[model samples]
Target: MPLAIVHQSYGRFGGAERVALAHFEQLRRMNIDATLFWSGLVTPGWQTRLKGYDIRTIPSTLPTPRNLATMIRFLRELSRYDSIIIHHHVDPLLALYLARNLGERTIWYSGSMFELAWEKWITGEDYRSISQTVKQTGQEYYGKTLSSLVLSNNVFDQTVRLARTVDIHAVRRYSKIVANSKFLSRFLKRIYKLNDTPPVVYPGPDPMLEQLSSKDFTGEGDYMLAVSPLIPLKNVDGMIQAASKVPSARLVVVGEGQDRVSLEERAGMLQVPLFLKGNCHSEEELAMLYSQCMFHIHLSLYEPFGLTPVEAGLFKKASIVTDHGGPPEIIVDGETGFIVNPRDYGMIAKRMKELLSSPELRHEMGQKARKRVLEKFTLERSAKQLLAEVES
Candidate 1:
């Protein structure tokens, strides 16, 4: 049976997409007949990346009411594959269709449950309920033979008002569950009310990191780093707020999004020496920047699975992440790096001062962080685990 690695969007190589794409490449390398199945338009840079890969695009259709047209096309195309590994979804209408139709023969490769659950609670009622393309019972996809429900994190606490336990229950009833971290799996089991413990699979550093030599990349001076798609959840503003308090701290943000203007304005108002390098041209450049930094600071209010921390770990740069989410899972508190409260920029600055003042502590934490990543999280390890689950 041929394999289909599916996702909502393909352009720009986001964190979740990177996980699926890495698996895609690995599967092909192992001689598995895998296809990159997606419905959206592939952006310019991604087209070059997928040049030799087996890609099959769905019919370009309207996407106003939750990609109903694409779902129709997806439904038409589902029967051909023996297994459908859902990497991500833009619409739960597809999940509803799959549970009622495909059932146990599916693998829900969850990047995050927040997107679907939150969307359904907000604007996806019309699409999940009564779309013009296909009408069915307003039930989420669940079945007896479900291969697995892979979840990145449990964002239930933040989205409680909008979503429900019943809604979470309907979605979590898979044959097996896969979580990206132990911290997340604990949240997953509690929130979804599951009996069985899910396996934790940490995503590795970007494949580009392996190509860069350590000698070629090294830190120049005392400057903190943050790599995030300039967004509110990433807390670029929070970083700026904290940076304004620490005069010796120099923050360099790598990545861009809609939140850039607002973050820039706030930084200007505070007179923080914040440099936003929109997007790294290549992973080599990104790795070099990581190497040059004293450490990486990631403060996400609602991060599911963070690959940037792992990348920072790979770069041998200690990652100072927010205590609340996946960063705690990756960073061994006060050992690999420090984990501070997401809402406390004062504490963030304090942690920054703790590391910035001591070069010995920074080196020790950086070494430990890199060792942890090398021992546990790697593309080879992740691909092997995924293949076992999919091929079993």
Candidate 2:
């Protein structure tokens, strides 16, 4: 039977969408019948690539209508698929409710604990009252009404708490729950009281990494790169503070979010040499930027499996990431890159200066980083793992 891959529609870009595209391409290459159901329209490039595949889009608003009618419509439509595989972007509880009536062959993929909490934090005001009312009503009422499934990705403790608050029985009722990292798997086990047998699947880089190797860096500057949403948890302000210590070293941030304006204002107030590159959708543009950088800086408070570091590695560029979460899994400390405490600006600056001052060391570390990714974190390896798990 064919597989039905269901994912939420935010934008056609981002890490999770890239992962979905990889899976779609892999499944097609294997001659497996697969269909993609999403809420938003696919990009023209993606549509062209997926010409012969069964792709469907159900038009819905950004913040989907929180009503029983909407839920019923989705549940009724989802009944057609033989099996459902939902990505983290979709609401887990909603997937559960739909799959419950559709019968047991359902699978879920979660990227990070931080993501769940991040969503709650972002939409806390709107949902807080509703959550309270549901809690007062009953578990069944809450389960049927609440749409979000994942929690925060800030700290392990928060991740655990969020899991406990959500109904795990609804989650476990599915055939499989796939976590994107070992750390995330452990978090799920601890919170949901499940056996240590949940699948752990590492995220892979976009195919753009392959084309990056041929690109030449023509950027003439002494700056490092930080590619992530300028959110509070990402610690973009901290990167700015660290940049102040090194007058010669500028920091280029490549992403857009609600915090962009505040981050820019803070950078000005601190007199930090920070360049806000906004959002770049072109792979060639990003590759060129990555190739020219001194190194990539990722100061995420907590990440499940950071792909930017791996992408930076593909470009033979060293990275300085937070000493926690999945960054350590990719960066081999002194060998490939440096891992410092997430909020320590002094330490971050020290490491940045160390890399900037020593060209040979940077080159050596960059080479090691590239070697590590090629050996373990490629999309081909990830696809093989996914197929093995599904077939098993």
Question: After superposition on all CA atoms, what RMSD does each candidate show versus the true structure?
Answer: 8.1, 6.4
lDDT of 2 by residue, 1-392 (tens): 67777776443256777688777787777786777876543555566677877777643322345665666676677777667777655543455464466537677777753233333543343222212221222222233333232222234345445543544555667677788888778776665677755788787786766567657667535789999876666778888888788767788999866677788898888887788998676667788788888899998876777889989999888999987677888899999999999889899889988998999989999999999988988887887787667666
Q: Which numbered prediction scores highest in TM-score against the true structure?
A: 2
| Tens-digit per-residue lDDT, 1-392, candidate 1 | 68777765522446776667677877788888888876553435556777898887643333345566666667767768887777644345455466556646667655566443453433334222212111111111222222022121243343333335434543554445567767667766776677776677677665657556265754455688998877556778898898888887889998776677888889899998888888776656777888889999998776667888888888777888987667787889999998888779889889888888888988899899988988988887887787677767
Residue 293 of model 2 has an lDDT of: 87
**Cα error of candidate 2 at position 101, Å:** 2.5
| Backbone atom clashes (below 3 Å) for every candidate | 2, 9
lDDT of 1: 0.68
- Give each model a TM-score: 0.80, 0.82
